[model samples]
Target: MNRLRANDWLFWGSVLACYLLQLMPLPQALLPLKPWWLALVLMYWILEAPDYVSLGRAFVLGLVGDVLAGELLGEQALRLCVACFILMRFRARLRFFPMWQQALAALALLANDRIVLFAIRAVSGEAAVPASYWLAPLTGMIAWPWVFLLLDDARARARVRES
Candidate 1:
């Protein structure tokens, strides 16, 4: 039988925390700048723990995210699934990228994410959003390095404690 690790709490905790962050209130003006916390968290796991997090797992979390955001059902699910699929296909190249380059990859992924959402909204004939809406992914990209480091450190510490 495969051994299960003892640091499960850390993984779940970080994921939950990201979801909670996604739900946090912000000023109306600041809403446009709120990064996709859940996506960033998902990207980390997709890169660092691919064995544990896969496309199906991303889709479920995306479903939860769709509900959390009160969006059209399956919007986030389809978006996240696509992102995860792309990431999984490119994992070999991305996983080895230096932190800076990884952040670039994150920026690209998030931009692609926005494009996917835009297409969906456009298809559904949703109202146009302000130009500021496009900037949120930039903030997410800028924060990627820090988020990566913090979670990676936490994972390392969690594993050490487990050992």
Candidate 2:
């Protein structure tokens, strides 16, 4: 019971941290390069603790993110739901892959996220995004290993403390 409680806090705390990171400001020149921090963190949780992170949870998180970022209300929610669905579908195989392989998978997932975002914007008749807008997923791919390791370490420490 204590372990479960610890895990819950760790999960939600990491998610909150990701939201902060996502909302943090960057120089205008670097804005397009900002990684999809929330997506990356949520992916870790979905893969590591499936029961704790579901499609509905992803949707809620994304909705919160959209409101926080001032994007279209359901944009992030839809993107997150799609990413969550894909991750959950392949969670079994992804869970056991080597970290390098997992990072590659992260790239694919993030790229798919970018595509979803593009489709959403296009349908909404938004202005064409600059080419640099696509760079975020690459940054996200590079950051995946570190994000995974950091969260994994934090989770381990949380369990150890409870033990």
Which candidate should be chosen as best, given lDDT against the real structure? 2
What value does the lDDT take at residue 25 in candidate 1?
91
lDDT of 1 by residue, 20-99 (tens): 98889999988888888888887888888887678888889899988888999899999989888988899889989998
Error of 1 at 46 (Å): 1.3
lDDT of 1: 0.85
- Point to the candidate with the largest TM-score: 2
Deviating ranges (above 4 Å) for candidate 2: none
TM-score on alpha carbons, each prediction: 0.93, 0.96
- For each candidate, what is the lDDT? 0.85, 0.90
Q: Residue 100 of model 1: what lDDT?
A: 88
